[model samples]
Target: MRATIIHGAGDVRIETVPDPVILEPTDAIVRIVRACICGSDLHPFHNKPAGSDPRAIGHEFIGVVEDTGSAVRTVSRGDFVIAPFVWSDGTCEFCREGLFTSCLHGGDWGDENVGGGQGEATRVPQADGTLIPVPGITEDSELLPSLLTLSDVYGTGYHAAITAGVRPGETVVVIGDGAVGLLAVLSAKQLGAEKIILMGRHEARTNLGREFGATDVVSARGEEGIAQVRELSGGHGAHRVLEAVGFLPAYEQALGVVRPGGAISRVGVPQYVEAPAGRVLFRPNVTLTGGVAPVRKYIDTLLPLVLDGTVNPGRVFDMTVSIEDVPSGYVAMDERRALKVLVKP
Candidate 1:
């Protein structure tokens, strides 16, 4: 089987690797049909040590079930499914509370010795709990992108809006124009937000953001960006602000653009950074929350929206490539030539 592996910083290759097999009664083996390069993958690509082992990379994927273990009942062989980026035991306390990402038994696919998304096939633990079956669209070609989004980006975007409590006629500001950020704009609109403000400089993405439902686009960067958001909201700031880029600046921007009593939903995969506790805890009644998206929880809710054509998350894919060309895919995204890269195995 062929998979994408990173041998070191800036080194990405497609090579043959051992196929995965079911390892637990709740596990399922999937033959990946499509996958995408996530922004998080770029962190290790640029910062990993020079001598790190060539490891599989990728976390978002949609595929067909090749095999399932005895405990798997929600999915079966030949069923098309989407694997949430985070794997969880559905019976865990956190999972029961709909916090699958924080499930006591939750685990990431490609971390340390675990294999990742850049693969021909992979084993998914807790299959019944993590894989969301795509009903009645077993042969739909366009379903791939929608299915793949369930793994991360779209789910995270939905998480951002929901966590912030976006409501009809309320104003929402999305910081960042990355795939997840753009999807956050979409999520806000779908949830009935009357005004969606997107802060970004890229014309391609900001344009897509408008098509998705951004009522306004602020191309300014830095403090100028924050000012533009405030101006749009008549100095009150937005009722809900989504921080989709996981960094200090973006986080700060989200905090700066929300109303005194509004909420900031951060779905960005945080790196080594800290937020000012004094500012967040004392300034206004701001509610700060968000983490890795509970993708499994949103999968069922989003699937129907995709199937009905009410939402088209696939628009986020600005470039498409074969899995063998994943290195270039990474380059395209990192260089800002692509919004999101879709890779087919």
Candidate 2:
């Protein structure tokens, strides 16, 4: 089988690799149908340490179950399913509490000898807990792109809004206009936020944010961007701030634009260890929250909405590529020429 491997920063390649088989009774082997490049994947593409062994990459995928281990009960061979970025045992205490990302037995793809999603197939641990079956939809349905988003970005964006406690008629500010940020705007709107200010420099991407429910677009950065968001929120800053870019500067913008007593929810994987925690957070009684989205927990909530056409998170995928061209997909996203790239294996 052919799979994607990252030899080092800016070096992604497609090469032949061994096919996957069940290593645990809870596992399933899924033949890839649709997969995608995530914004988080770019972090490693940009700064992965040199001289490390090449490893399989990619996490978001939708596939058909080719086989399942003896212990798998929720899905059978030939079932169409969505694989969350991480696999967790459904029986874990954290999973039961809707925090599958923190499950005691959970782990991410491309580690512990698991095949990555951007391949011919992958071994999905905790099959019953991690793979969500898609009913009544064909493999080629236009909704596949939307269903694919449930694997990560849509669920992640929703996590940002939900964690911040977005409510009806509240003011919300979403930082960034990437896939997650645009979807965060949609998520805030779904939660009934009456005003949404999207901070993004790209006019094309920000335009999508507007359609997603952003009442205003702030193209400036630093103090200027913060000022624009504050003015749009009627001078008090936003009731909730969703930071989708992982950089510290984006976090600082969130800190600047959130009103006192408001919350900041960050779905981006943090790129820094230390951030100002003194007066920036203490003076306002601000609540800082959000982490890796337990997307498995959100699949049920978001799947129905996709099936019903209430939302079209698939719009985030502006480019599609064959498995052999995945390296170019990464470059397109890294260069900001594409919002998100969909992969067809």
Candidate 3:
């Protein structure tokens, strides 16, 4: 088996690793078919603390079940399935309410001695709750990219829009132009946003945003960008703002373009923690809410669209490489030379 590992900043390698096996009664082993380098993965790729040991990387993948533990009854061997970036016990109260990210028993890949997804295979704990069977499965490699997005990216973009409370015929502005941000534009339109404004400067990426449903693309930055959005919204800010980039500047831009009473739904992993509530969040009377998306909760609502070809988030994969070339995938994404990278095992 081979897996991607990150030894420290700017250092990634594909090394032969031990094959995974079911270690718990509820575990399942999945032979990796497709995986991806996420925008969030770049955080640690470029910012991991110096002198950290090499650890397995990547969390998005879709594959066929090689085997399942005795307690795994919902899915059987040879079933094609997708697992969320995080693992959780479906019986938790928060999971019942569609907030699996906050489940009482939830964790992620690459921890607890679990093999990561961007590899030849992975051992998934809580298989009954974490691994979802892909409906009407066939071995069509073309469908892999789309199903792979359902594992995290599309579901995450869907989360940003849903939490923002995007409404039909309303004005919505999405910040950031990464894969998730581009998909956020698409999700907003699906939810019936009549006017979708995307704040991104990259010509190539913004072009896709327009194709995804962005009626307007604002290339300005700072207050200039905010002004452009305000003008497009007829002097008032957007009815809803989706912050898909978690940096302070991105967060600030989201607040800048949201209507006084509108909401900001963020899905990007926050790089900096918010300070104690202060004047910045007070004067506007706007709602600020978002956290790690409970991707498992939204998979059902999103899978049908992918399976039926209603939406194709797979377009974001600008580059693809063999699983062993994983380090270059990181480089391509980090340099913005690629919108997103896909790996085939």
Task: List, residue by residue over 1-345, the lDDT tens digit for candidate 1.
Answer: 888888888998898887888777888999888889998888888888888766778988888999999988999999988888888888888999899988897688876544578788888888888888786666457767877887999989999999999999999999999999999999999899999999999998999999999999998867888888899998979999999888888887887788998998888877746567676746698888877889888877898888888889998998999978899999998898999998888
Off by over 4 Å in 3: 275-277
Query: lDDT of each structure?
Result: 0.87, 0.93, 0.89
Top-down TM-score ranking: 2, 3, 1
* Candidate 3 local lDDT, 155-207, one digit each (tens): 99999999999999999999999999999999999999999999998999999
Among the numbered candidates, top lDDT falls to: 2
lDDT of 1 at 77: 94
Candidate 1 stretches with Cα past 4 Å from truth are 112-114
State the RMSD for candidate 2.
Answer: 0.8
Per-candidate RMSD, Å: 1.5, 0.8, 1.2
Q: In model 2, what lDDT does residue 253 have?
A: 94
Per-model TM-score, in order, reads 0.96, 0.99, 0.97
